[model samples]
Target chain A: MAEVTFDKVRKAFGSAVAVRELDLAIRSGEFVSLLGPSGCGKTTTLRMLAGLETPTSGAISIDGTVVNELAPAKRDIAMVFQSYALYPHMSVAQNIAYPLKKRGVSRADRDVRVAAVAATLQLGALLDRKPRQLSGGQQQRVALGRALVRDPRVFLLDEPLSNLDAKLRAHMRAELIELHRRIGKTMVYVTHDQLEAMTMSDRIAVMHDGVLQQFGTPKEVYETPANLFVASFIGSPGMNLVKGELRAAGSGLAFVRGDLSLPVANGGTAGAAVTLGVRPEDITLGAGPFACTIRVVEPTGHETIVMAEAAGETLVARAAPDSQLVPGQVVPFAVRAQRLHAFDADGRRLPLVFAQSNGA
Target chain B: MRNRSLTSRILLNVLAWSIVFVIAFPLVWMILTSVKPQFELFRIPPTILPQEVTFEHYHRVLVETPFLKYFRNSVILAVGTTVLVIVIATLGAHSLVRFSYPGRERLAQLVLFTYLLPSVVLIIPLYLLMVWLGIANTLFSLMLAYTTFALPFALWLLRSFMQGIPQDLEAAALVDGASRMEAFVDVILPQAVPGIISTALFTFILAWNEYLYALVLVNTDEARPLTTGVMNMLITAFNIEWSLLMAASVMMSLPVIIVFALLQKHLTRGFGAGGVKG
Candidate 1:
């Protein structure tokens, strides 16, 4: 296993930059995900690490050795593409054994190693089947098996689970976590799915528009998003953000916008413009200090997502699945005080101190 | 309604069969004419079927004329041209599809442009070049001449075929410790096998059926292929032997038929497996 680092790496395709000023260090044997939307340089970053695309500037090092000029074969890294990229012409066994053959492994050793990998991946029965003859999940395993046969220093996966169906993606996600645990290799997984990053990564590096927005553990990013982008991008149903200004309330501060006022536990410059952020689950829909008219109610089995309008701003709150909240019904709501987030006008998170007594 | 549908189905089948018969009639006539006796070809109005089947025309063509020698020369020219052209085109197509260089797209378009030029326009210069090189009147000269046209056609065809192969497969191979060339041999070449087979078949047929260059370039029996050699039999003879010429034409088509039979499976598989998804 090796620690991988991207030091001020920037990639440009002629004039347009794909990744800019990327500085990330992944610990050895850690499963870290590069999470972002499409065209956000996540795949480009992964390709750069795999030596598939050369970074336009800066250095990428593996195990303290810079690999900017090294060929992909010499980098000792294995990658699983989003399409799986199993060799269509080769049988499963031949596909898995290819890297070993290139490494000059003898036939006997290659067979033994391939058999061991096949058994690990439960692909023994599919050894003779071609890639097209296999199912999507099976092809995915063969792609993984091909990568695993080399046992390289690091594994780079570019949205490897995106092609699978939802159920299979979830199953494979758990399997990948177990595989990472067993192999203990430095794995750099690139994905746009925030849930995948939150579930599988030891640390998540959230990126947007070619810039690294936040890099922290899953809970750290979820509970304490570094900026407005991370705060809104990291959650299901997304965090509700209302534009307003901080004003002096009784003792502390209150965020005020027209007819709505909510006492906040944080101190900011009085009369300064700020956006109040709250998670859907942290908003109590039945009773609170603020009143809002329900605009839409989305029932998701265990929880119902309710979209409401308050003081001309839309807010989404999660309610019990059995709740009978309907559109256009005015309801009193309360936001968990300590669970609130405050961002400045520039979309940067402002530090907020929440005392224990401020809890709802 | 069921009866009406059945009537339309029958009419469709009749139309389809008529089209097939129209396309196949010449080939069927050739085979039948090759087997019929010379007397039966012009008897009265002409018989739809031969009353007496004889191998006399086949026997005379094989023994009396230099048909076997011409067949051997055709085989050499076709196989040699195919091997040479496919080797160059496969690599050229791969480079065009995968690599980036200055004027690469323009170069691909230029290759197709070369193929668009009629061979009749090129034969004179080609013949002069072959004579200057001292290889004229030889099978090697014809092979070189065939490649001028065949290479461009093969390269253009194989480029699109190679483009259908996903780039991720090569990247996956490279990341799996295979060098660029090694990955190409192991991954790209195997995926391109169907395309290569089809291109080879096309190149072989073009070389085998070429007459203008063969007629102008080579006059010796040692180097003349079946196309020009068969045509020479028609003009040089005292009397036109229709059955004999038909027999030679039948024999000339056998190799292509056999090659198509052998590679038919791969050709069909190529269409179905054009791209790798998921």
Candidate 2:
């Protein structure tokens, strides 16, 4: 296992930049996921690291060794493609043993190693079967087995769970985590799904428009996001932002959001226009400072997401499923004072105090 | 889902058989005519069935004349052309379809143009070139001419088949410690059996049926192929044997028919595989 480090790596396709200046250091034996929207350069970054794509500038090193010009085969990395690119003409045994044979392993040992890997993948009975005879999930297992047999220094996965069904994806996600734990090899996985990143990564690297937005553990990213993009992109029902002018109302201050004014817990400054950000679950639906018009109610078994409008801004409030509410009804919601986040005009978070400023 | 009436079902069966018979009539006529007596062969009213049949024509064609020499020459040329066309076309098509290079579009279009219209106009220029190379009227010249006509068709057909394979299969091989060429030979080409077989059979049949080039290029009977050999039998003395010529014609067509029947499965698979992709 080796730590992979990218030093200002950049990749461009002709004039179009697929990945702009990117720098990340993944610790040895840690699972890191590059998560972003489609066309956001997550796959490009993974391909660059695997040597499938050449970087336009900067260098990628493994274990403090420069490998910017190394070919993929010489780099000693095994990659599992999203399509599960198994050899259609070969049986499962031959497919899994391909790398070993290339490396000049003994004939008897290759067969034995293939058998053992097959048993681990629950593919003992499918050794003689061609790829066409196997189902999609089985084919994926065979693909994984082929990569695992080589025992390369690093394992690169490019959205490997995408081709499977929903339940199979979840099952494979857990199995991949367990496999990584058992083998304890350094791995870099790429996916667009945030849940896949949060579930399987030691550290999730969130990207946007070819730039790294945030790189931290899931807890750090969820609780204290670096910017507006990371805060909005990582959550399912994303954090809400109510734009308003910051003013001193009571002992501390309050956000004056048009006709609806709400008190801020630790707010400051009377002149700067800032945004009040809070999670939907942080807003209670019973009584509070501002009144909102309920537009739609969506119950997702555990919590109901109530779409509401206040001060010409669309908002969503999460409540317990037991709350009896309907569309077009007026509702009052309160925030947990201390749970408020204030951002300046440039979308940078600002730390404000409760008793610092009085009235404007 | 279906409880069809017996009359309509029988009518459909009869229609199917009629189409089959229409397709297979030429071979039956050739074979039956080859064994007929001389009086029945050119009867005023063509007879479908003859009262008497004999192997006298087969014996004459096999023993007398230079028919055996023509058979040997045709076999060598056809087989040689088939092998050459399949190998060269496969490599050329794979290079065009799999890799990136300058002028690939122009080269691909050239192959398509040649395939869509097999160029018989090149015959005169090629005939002069063959004579200039001091190989005219030789079996080697016939082989060269046959391969030229056969290769463009093989290249275009195999290219369509190669385009259908997923490129990720080769990419996986490259990352798994094989060079790009090794990946193609080991991982990609094995799955292209259906394409290779079809290209070979197509080249074989084209060279077998080609008559214009053979008629104009070859002169002496020693280096003559079967197509020209059959025509040479028509020119003789007043007592020219008609049954012997028909037997030789039937013999000329036997290999073509057998090859078609055996390779029809692979040819159908090749065409069917393409319909589902691209």
> In DockQ terms, which candidate is top?
1
TM-score of each: 0.90, 0.89
**RMSD, candidate 2, Å:** 3.6
**lDDT at residue A285 of model 2 (Cα atoms):** 84
Q: Best by TM-score, which number?
A: 1
Candidate with top lDDT is 1
- The CAPRI class of candidate 1 is medium
Candidate 2: chain B TM-score against the reference chain B: 0.87
lDDT of 2 by residue, A305-334 (tens): 888887898888888988898988998777
TM-score of 2: 0.89
Question: When only chain A is evaluated, what TM-score does every model earn?
Answer: 0.96, 0.93
| Interface root-mean-square deviation, each candidate | 0.8, 0.9
Candidate 2 CAPRI level: medium
Predicted candidate 1 versus true structure: per-residue lDDT over A1-360, tens digit per residue: 799999999999878999999999999999999999998999999999989899999999999999999999899888899999888888999999988988899999999999999999999999999999999999999999988988799998989999899999999999999999999999999999999999999999999999999999999999998889999999999999989898887788777787877776656778889888889999888886678999999998988999999889898899999999989899988777788888999999888653323322
lDDT of 2 at A342: 71
Residues B1-278 of candidate 1: C-alpha lDDT, one tens digit per residue: 99999999999999999999999999999999999998799888888888889999999999999999999999999999999999999899999998888899999899889878988998889889999999999999999989988998788778878888889999988888888888889899988998888888889889989998999989899999999998888556478778999999999999999998999898776544544331
